[model samples]
Target: MQPYCKLKSSTRSLSKLVACSALLLLLDLSRCFSHHTYEWQDSHTNERLVCKQCPPGTFVSQHCTRDSPTICKQCPKLHYTEYWNYLESCLYCNVFCNFLEEEAQPCNSTQNRACQCKPGYHAELDFCIEHSSCPPGSGVAQLGNPQQDTKCSQCPQGTFSSVSSMDPCRNHQNCSAQHLEVNVPGNRFHDTFCTACKISKGSEASDGLEDGSGSEDCQDAVIDFVPYEIRVPRRLRRLKRIVSRSSQSSKRDRKSLEELQMELHTYLVQLKNTEKKELLLMFITAGIVSQSEVAPFQISAGKESLQVRRK
Candidate 1:
């Protein structure tokens, strides 16, 4: 019922009389209800009553009555209520993730379950497929994630992809830039194969050779157990001899192999043009280190790896 207010004083100002009635009307509203409530007509008394809404995770089991308040009940398992509601029953969980999909967020009293693709897979219409493997001569343009698939692209010129993998196109080994002779040029499928010891043309002329020809033979190189005739450079011969002599597994021996290999590698890297030893012995495959640099490993036998050729 509305509150009654009568400003009977003739001495009272017009603003004061309006304020008195407004205050009494606000008091009547406070006595009825506040936020998060609704008015309903009581079936027994035929009177309107304001009832509070049930909080999240619970629902109104019965409406407000003249003698009793609105009755609320807790949601059962696998059911949920998001906010203050007068719903009779909580919502049921109907969504389910598939085999290839993983639950990103578990279902709770307030939120629904969310799913996404697992690792190495990407989401499609309703399911997920495995990420694409970049084929030989092709490469991954973009890496795949939970929502997107791996993008593939063909290897461009001067680059190659030798394996079926997710990696991108690898820059081909630049033999000319490394000051080495290119025996087999690089394509999209394979990398440039460079000579093991000998340097290519155009290098010696830069070093004051009148008519530069990189083909210079060596009499000191030898044939070894490997298919290629491994040749030690003139600068590295001393270190190779020392490593060959060390038989005991001492601290000196531990450092000897590493030092010898490093010295040999440094000499080969620095040895350009005329300084580079040309393949003298007519071996089908010739290399100072190993023929296949892709699978290059240390030759443990220092003596056999660097034995001097006899006269």
Candidate 2:
């Protein structure tokens, strides 16, 4: 009986030791899981591990094992990881700005590079374009900024602009109402050109006509010289008197009269070749005719009659 009692006491002691070992193992597992650690099994070694998360701006190079801690590395230049991750490699941060654009902010481990349009350039959809300049006869309605294009508007009446630029149009010159005539009319791109009115001698004031007293004799001579339309002004009528009085003049005056006659002959030849009645009328109205001797002139065009008398 003493030998059987010793065997039973030894068996009870072995069972108690086994229960205590199991309880200690469960406590260790609960403590590990409660601390936010996760277990990962290795495929090659079949070993379990508790892995810690990688910090920001770094990536996990190797997972943790039961015997070793997790391995991590900082992200290289031009690479980034914005948050804690278990990725094996960092993301590339090599974004580039296009033409007409510039880098506003450089890339770093935590953020990407920012881009913006350059000066004198505006954003248009996905690209950039240069600002537009206002053209002649127009003004800049709105100036351009870095993010927007320029706006233009036409110049109003009494204003003019001659060149393309960002400046506003200028006001046109106003002609005097009394003595000046509008030689060239005002336009959006050019100012008005004015000329003084021609005053006549004696009692009658010929506003545009040249001074002449011997007009009837020249009228008869012109009728015999040309059959076609020749609207001669009063100044041209005086040329007949120059020819009639040339023989009575001195040697110097005769030489001057001859040169004048040659110039008139050349002009008449050009007028005949061109046969431009409107050009001849403009010469008559603008007082371009000379008071010198004219050669025999003949022009033939349609049935338009010649008016030698000045209005």
Candidate 3:
């Protein structure tokens, strides 16, 4: 019983020794973990640190001692710091939008610039709108929406538009019957009338004007007026007055010559007619004389015939 008690005591002591050694090893590991540190630098490179690195998305603007971590500041207003142990200063924010006044927000070291539309100008699409009305004689055909202006056009000459718009033309010619031959088709300002062309004696026209005054070419009418030459009888030609260039012949001499020729021609025609009349008279006289002579012979023949018949 005494030997069994000594073996149990030795075994118990060995277990206690093993437990104490494990406890010492754990304490040593804790001290090593506590002593673990990282060197850090400030943005100006003027300060130093003896601790772990700063967190991501944050930058150390100033160094810290063993008792304190580095002073980490957020990036300037709208900007952000995305680096670790940043040796440079924090960046500023960029403009959120642009402006036409040239007073837009400026971009920063860490952000890009932006743009936007102005007031009274809707940016529904990519265009601007002016809800202004059309001028006096003009009107709008298509009324623009919030993004576009209302388009207006002019009222044409013949058209009388009460309102200005982009509408099509309307007012037309007011031609009526009674003087209405054919409506010369056009706008209201042009020739729309109740007039007609002239109709003259021995001439005609499609418009209301005299011959040679109308559309007919005067040159063309002259061409039709006179022929190149004319012809007359030889007897009439002899009666025409002739100008004499001879020294002995006066102007009156040529006139006398023409008169003489006309008289000669007239006498020749009269003589020919007289001869024809005398021959007709001679034939008649011969016919009467022959008839008388023949009648006496017939009577004597008849008497002879009667005596023979009596015998």
Candidate 4:
């Protein structure tokens, strides 16, 4: 009877253990099912509904009901969502290429337009501005890019620029006029200045006496007018005549003609300088030169010269 009692007690303990294991397995299965069911619940609605998320490039047109799936529509023109969303309407694309800006990329259902600065303009902060040019006496320190403006710096000593551009400053010209000495050293902002020699007349005379030359002979003659002013127009006229006569000149002569053209250009620069100085002097003396008279003076370069015409 004791052995039978012991076997019956072991059987009861095994049955209780089996019942507990079954209950734990059922509890796990129920929890998993509940999680799966609630995963797609709509949070905005009072009555929670199982709703699938709208895909990218689309927006929800209608909410999911108990028996229906979420209704979605493709984003309209110039509209985009980019990512999956539960939004009721598509987002409007706000990017636009204005007058100074250009379209880098066109708008699509999934993305907004991309913009950049147009040619001759550069982006600064949030907007576009006209590209800057290095003015005369300055040079481009840094080139302009799509996103940045051109940077300019003052030309260093012994160099200069005469026009507004992106070019580097050029070296100052040496004094070439006879019997003249440099009065002022050139800087980045101004040209090298030249003037007559400042040695005393008595010193020059003494030097001449030592060399057995007269005082008058020792002194260099001061020019009344710039040689370039008198010579350039005549040279230009001569070149034009040559060009007219050279219609039959061979291609081999073209090289010589180009050399002449370069020479002419140098002369023209000198003439321009002379004229500029003269005009400045006239302004200082007379305050103003009549525009009509100035026009005629420019046209009749050889026949009419600038004179103090009292009227």
lDDT of each: 0.56, 0.54, 0.37, 0.53
Worst 10 residues of 4 by lDDT: 217-226
Once all C-alphas are superposed, what RMSD does model 2 give against the true structure?
Answer: 23.2
Q: What does candidate 1 score on TM?
A: 0.46
Tens digit of per-residue lDDT, candidate 4, span 64-172: 7777788899999989988767788888889888888888888988888999998778888888888898976799888887789989998987798756787778888
The true-versus-predicted C-alpha distance at residue 217 of model 2, in Å, is: 37
- Please identify model 1 stretches exceeding 4 Å from their true place: 1-51, 66-71, 136-138, 153-158, 174-179, 197-311
| Better lDDT candidate (2, 4) | 2
lDDT of 2 by residue, 145-250 (tens): 7678888899899987656788787877766764554433566755565434221222332222232222332322332222112234323334433323333433
Q: Candidate 1: how many backbone clashes?
A: 0
The number of clashing residue pairs in each candidate reads 0, 0, 15, 0
Error of 4 at 29 (Å): 26
Q: Which stretches of model 3 miss by more than 4 angstroms?
A: 1-58, 64-67, 75-79, 82-88, 94-97, 100-311
RMSD of 3: 41.5
- Give the higher-lDDT candidate: 1 or 4: 1
TM-score of 2: 0.36
